[model samples]
Target chain A: MRRLHHWPLDPASRAARFALAEKGLDVDLEEARPWLRAEPLFRLNPAGGLPVLEDNGATIAEIGPVLEYLEDAYPGQPLMPRGAVERAEVRRLIGWFDVKYNGEVNAYLLHEKLEKRAQSLGAPDPQAIRDGRDHLRWHLDYLAGLLDERDGLAGPRFTLADIIGAAHLSCADYLGDLPFDEFPAVKTWYSRIKCRPAFRGLLADRLPGLPPAKHYDDLDF
Target chain B: MRRLHHWPLDPASRAARFALAEKGLDVDLEEARPWLRAEPLFRLNPAGGLPVLEDNGATIAEIGPVLEYLEDAYPGQPLMPRGAVERAEVRRLIGWFDVKYNGEVNAYLLHEKLEKRAQSLGAPDPQAIRDGRDHLRWHLDYLAGLLDERDGLAGPRFTLADIIGAAHLSCADYLGDLPFDEFPAVKTWYSRIKCRPAFRGLLADRLPGLPPAKHYDDLDF
Candidate 1:
C-alpha cells in the first residue's frame, strides 16, 4: 500500500493528491505541516515538507518528484502527454504556476491570510494583499487568454499543468481572492477542471475560523 | 543544434548548463539578464528568465523542464540513474538546492553581493547578508553530513542533485560566503565535482567590476 503525507490547502500537497487521484491510485493519508517541522516528516524528507509519498519501500519527497514518480511508476493512466517537447511545455506551465504564480499570488494571500493566522505570526499586511490581488487579475487574464486557444493550459488535452494551475488558484479561491468574473475563459476552464473527481477532495478542505468563499465548492461556480 | 540562453551567475542557469554539459550536448550560447526584463526573453519564456533552451523547433524554458528535456530527448549519456525511486531522490535533491538552499543562502548573497551591484538596486541589507552567511554555515555542515554518508548528494552515482548543489554552492563560493574548513566532507565533494570538464566553462565566467572569490576556480581548493 502507498501512503502520502500531506497538509490540506498546501498547493504542493493538492497537486500530488490530484496526480494520485488522476492515476486512480489508492494512498493512505497522513497530515503533515512544514511549519511545524515535525521530526518524522524530516526523517522521511530532509527538506522537511509535506506531500512525501512512501511506496514500495521508497520514499518520494518534494512535489516535482512526487508527480514524476506517479507518472513513471504508474504508467497506466498518463497525466503527461506522449512527446518530449509536449512534456516540456507541460512541465514549464507547472513551473509557471508552482513558482511564478505562487510568488505573485499565493505567497502573499496564503502566507498572510491563512498561514500567519495558523502559526500566530501576525495579521495580513494590507500592502502585500493589495499587491497579490493586483497580480491575480493579471494572472487570471493570462489564464483566460490561454484557455481561449487551447482546451487545456499546455495543449488540447488535460495534463499536470492544469492540475497545478487549479491547485494554486483553488487556494486563492478559498480565500475569496480570485476574480473569475473578469476572465470568463479561465472561469469556464476552471469550472470544467473543478468538476473532476480528482479535485473534489481539495475543494472540500476547510481551515479553522476561516470559511471558504461563497462560490467555493459550488460545481457551477 | 541546441541553443541555450543563460546568465553566468544565475544558479538555475548554472544548473541547466551543468545538466547540458553532463549530457555532453553541444549548445550555442546567448547571455540573458532577467532583471533587465528583456522583451525577447519574455517571448521565449513567459516566466521571463534565463536558461531557456531552443532545440529542433522546441523552446524548453525553465530549469526543471530544460533538464528533463535533455534527459528525455538526448538519453545519450544519462545524468539521471535508472529506476523510479532513485530518480525521486535525485529530483528531491534538486528541489533541496533550487528552493531550500537557494532561499537560505544564495538568494541573499547573489542578490546582495552581485545582482544589486549589477542592477544598481541600492546596497545589500546587512541583516540579509548576516542571515545568509549564518545559514551558509548550517547548510555547508548539513552538506558535509550528507557527503559523509553518501558518495554524492543523492547516492553512489552523480546526478542532477550534485549538479544543483555544486551549482548553488559555486555561487556562494563566488561570494566567499562558504566556510569550507568547517565542513571537510562537503569541501571534498566540491573539489571532486568542481574538477569535472563539464564545470570548466562556468568556472571561467567573470562579471565586469566583480571578481569571483579567490578560490572560486581552484581545482583543489
Candidate 2:
C-alpha cells in the first residue's frame, strides 16, 4: 500500500502528486497541513514537512527525496533524463523552482494570501505582495525565454522540471497572480502540460471559503 | 580540465569541494562572489548561483545537481547509499540542512555576520542573531539525538549528509557561532569528519579582512 501525505495547494506536495500520477502509480492521498505541525505528521517526518510518501513500511519525506524515491523504486516511467548533463539540467531547474522561485515569490505571496488565513496572521502586507509580484514577473520572463527554444523547461521531453514549474505556477494561478498573457511562450507551454492527465488532481482543488481565480481550472484561459 | 567556480565560505560551495575531493576528481577552484552577480557567472548559470562546476565542456550549477552529477559521472567513493530507502534518508538530511537549517539559522546568522560585511549593510541585528542561535541549538539537539543511534547521519556510512552538515556547521563555527561544547555528540561527530583530507581545503579558507574563530580550523578543539 502506497500513501502520500500532502496539502492540496502546497507546491512541493503538488509536485509529488504530479510525479506519482505521471508514473501510473496508485497512491492514497492524505491531506497534511504543514503550518499546523501535527503530531502524526511529525511522527512520519521528524522535520514536519509536507508531501511525505509512505510505501508499505518505508517512509519518504520532503519533495526532493520523495521524487528521487519514486524514480529509483518505481522507474517504470522516467521523470529524469539518462545523460549526466541532461540530468544535471533537470536538477538545476528543480533547484530553481524549489529554492529561488519559492524564496523570491511564494515566501511572500503564499504566506500572505494563503498561510496568513490558516494561521489567522492578520491582513496581507501590500508592499510584500507588490515585491512578490515584481519578482514573479522576472521569473516568468526567464521561463518564457526558456520555453521559446525548448519543448519543455529542461529539454525536449516533459520531465520533473515541468512538473515542478507547473506545481508552483498552478499555485500562483490559483491566487490569480500569474500574468499568463504577458508571457505567451510560458502560457503555451503550460497549456500543453496542463492538458496532461496528471494535472487533473490539481485543477479540482478548492480551498473551501478561499476560492481560486475564475480561470483557475479553465484549460482555454 | 575540470574547474569549480565557488565562494569559499558558502556551505553549498564547500559541499561541492568536499564531494569532488572525495570522488578523487581534481578540480581547479575558482572563487565567484554571488553578491556581485558577475556577468561571467550569469553566462554559465542563468540563475546566478555560486558553486557552478564546469567539467570540460559541460557546465553544472548549484549544489543539488552538482552533487548528483558527481555521483553519476564518478561512482567511486559513493556519497549516497545504494538502497532506495537509504538514499532517500540521505536526501532528507540534505534538504534538512539546505532548506530548513539554511532558513532558520544561516538566513539570520550568516546574513548579519557575513553578507552584511560583503554588501556593506549596517550593523547586525541582535534579535535576529539571537533567534538564529536559538534555532541552531534546537537543530544541534536534533543532530545529537540522531548521532546517539547511528554512526553517521544517514546510517553507519559517511554520506553527503555528513558533508552538508559539516559545511553549514563549519560556516557557523567560522562566524564564532555553533556551541559545540553544549552538544558533545555533534562535536565528536564533527571531529571525525573534520580530520578527513576532503575537509582540509575548507579549513584553509580565509577572507582578506575577516579571520575565522580561534579554533575554527583546529582538529581537536
Candidate 3:
C-alpha cells in the first residue's frame, strides 16, 4: 500500500496528490502540518517537510523526489514529455514555479496571508501583501507569454509542468489573490486544467476557519 | 560544441559545472553574473539565472534542468544510480540543499557576504551571519549523522547527491564559513569528494577581489 502524508493546501503536497491521481495510484492520505514538525514526519523525512511518500517499505520525501519517483516507478501514465529537450523545458517550468515563483510570490503572499493566520503569528503585513501582488502580476504575465506559445505550459500535451503550475495557482486562487481576468490566456489554460479529474481532490480542499474564494470551485469563472 | 554560461561562486552553477565535468563532457565556459541580467543571458533563459547550458541548438536553463538534461541525454558515465529508490534519495538530497539548506544557510550567509559584496550592496549584517552560522551547525550535525551510516551520501556509490552537496558546502568553505573540525565525518566525506577530478575546476575558481579560505583547495584539510 502507498501512503502519502501531505497538507491539503500546500502547493507541493497538492502537486504530489495530483500526480498520484493522474498515475491512477491508490494512496492512503495522511494530513501533516509542517509547522508542528511532528515526530512521525521527522522520522520518515529527517528534513521535516511535507508530501512524504511511503511505498513498498521505501519512503520518498519532498515534492521533487515524490513526483520523479512516480515517473520512474510508474511509467504507464508518463506525465513527462518524450524528447530530452522537451523534458528539459518541462523541468525548467517546474523549477520556475517551485523556486522562482515560491520565492517571489508565495513566500510573501502565502506566508503572510495563509501561514501567518494558520500559525496564529499575528496580523499580515500590508506592504508584504502589496509586494506579493506586484510580483504575482509579473508572474502572470510570464505565464501568459508561455501560454501564448502552446496549449500547455511546456507544450501541446498536458504534463507535470501544468500540474505543478496549476497546483500553485489554485492555492493563490483559493485565497482570492489571483487576478484571473487580467491575463485571459493564463485564465483559459487554468480553467482547462481545473476541470481535470486529477485536480478534483485539490479543488475540494477547504482550509478550516478560513474559507476559499467564492468562485474558486466554479468551472466557468 | 557544448557551452555553459555560469557564475563561478554560484552553488547551482557549480553543480552544473561539476556534473558536466564528471560526465567527461568538455564545454566552453562563459561567466554570466546573475545580478547583471544581461540581454544575452535573458535571451537564452527568460529566468535570467546563472548556469545556463547551450548544446547542439538547444539551451537548457537553471541548475535543475541542466543536470537532468545531462542525465537524460548522456547516460554513459551515469551520475545517477540505477534503482528508483536510490534515485529518489539523490533527488531528495538535491531538494534538501536546493531548498532547505539554501533557505536556511545560504540565503542569509551567502546573500549577506558574497552577493552583497559582489553587488556592492553594503556591509553584511552581523545578526544574519550569526543566524546562518547557527543553522550551518545544525546542518553539519545532520550530514555527520548520515555519513556515520553510509559510505557516501544516498549509498556506497558517489552519486549526484554528493556532487550537489559538495557544491553548496564548498561555496561556504570558499567564504571560510564552514567549521570542518566540529564535524569530522562530514569533513572526511568532503575531503573524499574534494579529491575528485571534477572538483578541480571548482577549486580553481576565484572572485576578482575576494579570495577563498586558505585551506579551500587543500585536499588534506
**Candidate number achieving the greatest DockQ relative to the actual structure:** 1
Interface RMSD values, listed in order for every candidate:
0.9, 1.0, 1.1
C-alpha displacement of B31 in model 1, angstroms?
1.3
List pairs with backbone clashes in candidate 1. none
lDDT of 3 by residue, B1-221 (tens): 79999888889989999999999999999988889877999999998987899999999998778888999999888888888899999888988888889999999999999999989999999999999999999999998998999988888898888988999999999999999999999999999999999899999998888999999999998
lDDT of 1 by residue, B45-143 (tens): 988886899999889998878888888998887778888888888888877876788788878888888889889999899999998999889888888
Residue lDDT tens for model 1, A1-221 = 79999988888899998889999988888888789887999999887877899998889998888988888889887889988899999988877876788888888888899888888998799999999999999898888878888999999999888988888889899999988888888888899999999888888898878899999999997
Look at candidate 2 and tell me the lDDT of residue A89.
94
Positional deviation of residue B84's Cα in model 1 after best superposition, in angstroms: 1.3
Chain B vs. true chain B: TM-score for each candidate? 0.96, 0.97, 0.96
lDDT tens per residue, model 2, A1-221: 99999988899999999999999998999988878888999999998988899997999998888888888998888988899899999989988988899999999899889999889999999999999999999999999888888999999898989999999999999999999999999999989888999899899999999999999999988
Evaluated on CA atoms against the true complex, candidate 1 attains a DockQ of 0.82
Note the clash tally of each candidate: 0, 0, 0
Summing lDDT over every window of 10 consecutive residues in candidate 3 chain B, give the lowest-scoring window.
Answer: B151-160
C-alpha lDDT of all candidate models, in order: 0.87, 0.92, 0.91
